[model samples]
Target: MSALDPSVAGQLAEDLPPDVFRTIIATFEEDLTRLVQELQTAHESGDQNGYERAAHSLAGASAAVGAVGLEREARIAMDHRQPEAAATVLPRLVAEAKGALEALHALIH
Candidate 1:
């Protein structure tokens, strides 16, 4: 599957003004970076609650932006009850986020 759902993104772009859409995309990028960092730190620190919280936040944000792959990965991360389990999925989650961001950026530019 694609990192982003183009139809959903296209709809969003069509519904919002150019500047507003750009702002949302920019905010998503910034939030994605911060959430991914939080996920990493939580994993490294063995903070399962923090890891799950970050994953949940990421999933929600990704969904809003039509970042399907990232949202899927984030949901998977959220499902993990243990830090070690979440750690296994961290790389995939990060990769998906990167791909999603790229796709989202393409929509605005």
Candidate 2:
């Protein structure tokens, strides 16, 4: 087993493993990418609902990983009356959150 194994950290194999860790990272990355793209599309098309939904999802995912700072930023972005400001903020949120998720995988794997 790897030194970073969750199994060695008093965690059970059934609850954690390298494969599961990778999947979690990949899933988060893919979703974040999609969310950012959707936010851009919404901004381009002036779709307020899409902006809100994507920003909401980004905030939730960021919060899940204890990324309260990013979550707050995302919330502020969502609060902006103009989609341009939200667009400017959404990419940073996605990038930083992706970094956090990758770091999480490294810690567990």
Largest TM-score belongs to which candidate? 1
lDDT of 2 by residue, 5-59 (tens): 2332224224567787567656666777787788789878999788888888877
Per-residue lDDT tens digits of candidate 1, residues 1-109? 8898877888898899989999999899899889999999988999989988999999999999889998988998888654547657888988898888788778874
- Quickly count the clashes in candidate 2: 0
Worst 10 residues of 1 by lDDT: 79-88
TM-score of each: 0.91, 0.66
Q: After superposition, how far is residue 27 of candidate 1 from its true place, in Å?
A: 0.5
Candidate 2: 10-residue stretch with minimal lDDT: 1-10
Off by over 4 Å in 1: 81-84
